[model samples]
Target: MFKKAFFAGIPVAILCLGLLTGSCQSTGTNKRDKEGFTAIFDGKTLQGWEGDPTYWRVEEGALVGEITPTTLLKTNSFIIWKGGTPADFEFKGSFRITTDGNTGINYRSEQLTDIPFALKGYQADIDGKIRYTGQNYEERGRTTLAYRGEKVTVNTQQNAADPESFRANVKNNAWQARQVTGSLGSSDSLQTFIKSNDWNDFHLIIKGNRLLHYVNGKLMSDVTDNDTVNRKMQGLLGVQVHVGPPMKVQYRNLRIKQL
Candidate 1:
């Protein structure tokens, strides 16, 4: 009777172990699928990215880009992600920049083989000076499409006579600005939301020709691109280490979900 009882218990123990392993695997998958986003950075290495090793690396679980005075670039360089090109998606990340550092998240961009890791397209600007931070900029293209706290509708057919004309058009439509309320009254108010030398959360949402940039949970810029002639629908994604001064920018918790 004792031998029969011990043999029967072995099968029960095996079944319990299998159930525990299956439960753990399911939990991990659910955690990664939270909010329908997947992490782009592994927090260990630059395995799925392409860039000059001299300027980009993983440090302390963050993707770090640094340029010393001795290694100043003649033109902006980027670390391009080799992952799939996302047409419509939401990107979320946390960043910290030095006082002299200038960086950006470039999306829907194209690479320039002539310049070695050079990218040109839409850039969600980031700067330590707080001047261009939270703006929608086109790299090597149309330049600043929208500034902080401005809601802009770009009519590619309407050619402005000068820079002032373009600025006037954007401001005239200020009443249409999205996500401006309470603490986020104006562009200056948005600037106050930035932490400067400390970490700040950035969110970029793009669907079709519309783009929105948010910093620290505040909407900083809104753009509706009507430039069908030159606008990009899809391209590469990259992070920039701008040319000039010794500076460092660190990014972590990078994730995106294609919509």
Candidate 2:
């Protein structure tokens, strides 16, 4: 009777062992798709993401972010990711503006938080004047207002500098696609560009600290890692809803492919 009982339980033991080993590895990581890529946003919900829930929404099949009056979405503080090392790859998504201007997104972030990072890293920008498109700030990044001495000048040429340039490019608030390919260099230096009206694609290749920002298939910002100390950038991927009039925006088809 004892021998018969032990033999009968063999199949059950094998199944249990398989279940335990399978779950352990996938719990902290994502499997690559058949296209040899792994998707970040699931397209329907904010799974594998944690942050100020008030900052984002999943509405009518779109991943949305907005700025509420008297509210700091702090969407620019963290990224929702599958468990894995921050991989260097191409990030692409479709977006539409629905607010009172001033909006941007961050990439190649090292972590998540509200503290200023000095000469630590860089953020790829998204500027839609009616929705805060191309304005890059050193939010806990290397550049601080207090540290800007007497003759320091802020660079605002990345996203047309003003609304007129933004309005002239967008057509009746249409949906536009944007992309950033972060290719780091051996040194950890970086730079990025933007595209708004057109279905523009920017390729960012980061090989270590070295980075590049290509806009609408053009080289816009070619900067390197300068140990000069600019805090507020780099650390975690985040979306920014500037302190301004209330606004809303929609995004979809978000995908990431490691290179």
Candidate 3:
């Protein structure tokens, strides 16, 4: 009878161990399994965002934007997120662009009725040609605040005081040439990190006046905006469908963490 009891207990213990293993593996499909980030895309519908139906849709578990020759845009367009305007946050998503397409992730932006579904503010530049991926650009504002592989501090006051002197000081320095400083690796190195025409991860971390952009885990640009008069503190978020040659761009696995 004792031997029989021991064998019965062995089976119960095995079942308990299997149940524990199954529980440990059921963490959902969200990327990174990050502890605090919230998913913004439901992967099935455009429930929380707004954009021109002509250019945006949900396809194959991704948010897709396509523009054909007949659907050419008169001006740039965006799919604005209706979620609360984030002041400080970390945003991440996977993106892919066709050879002729260009897109950007716009944040801290405002919608303008002048151009329907248009957004104006900071943009994380993305292009199929890999020319501007992972850079900081301001839509309809102070464009190209920081380029790939740059660490910049924008001080409009100093730049305005002595334009010629400032230009000369940072002449050979790519970062300072933009009236900003440099950090991380060189632009050439950044280009190597970007995978053109393929799915790649883009990330943005924004806290107050400081912003950081990354591509595929490589630091692309960092900026500290000192232009208090023009720098935006917070606003809407959107993705762009640049007005140019016909093409397509797809985005997936979007998540954000408010800081």
- Number of the predicted model whose lDDT against the real structure is largest: 3
Off by over 4 Å in 2: 1-36, 70-79, 85-87, 110-121, 130-138, 144-203, 226-235
Candidate 3: segments with Cα more than 4 A from true spot: 1-33, 158-178
Superposed on all Cα atoms, the candidates' RMSDs to the truth, in angstroms, are: 14.4, 16.0, 15.3
Give each model a TM-score.
Answer: 0.79, 0.53, 0.80
Q: Each candidate: what lDDT?
A: 0.75, 0.40, 0.77
**In candidate 3, residue 104 scores what lDDT?**
97
Q: How much does candidate 2 score in TM-score?
A: 0.53
lDDT of 2 by residue, 1-259 (tens): 0011110111121222222222321212244456434345556666644444555667877667666676544333333332333335555556666525454445555553333211123554555542222222234343221110111223323343245553443333310111222322211121122334333344444444344444345443343343222222223344444445677666665554555
Per-residue lDDT of model 1, residues 35-151, tens digit only: 766566778777667777778889999999999867778888788877656678889999999999999999999998677778999999999999889988888766777778777
Higher-lDDT candidate among 1 and 2?
Answer: 1
Which of candidates 2 and 3 is the stronger one according to lDDT?
Answer: 3
> Model 3 Cα displacement at 197 (Å)?
1.6
Best by TM-score: 3
TM-score of predicted structure 1: 0.79
* Steric clash count of candidate 3: 0
Cα error, candidate 1, residue 191 (Å) = 0.5
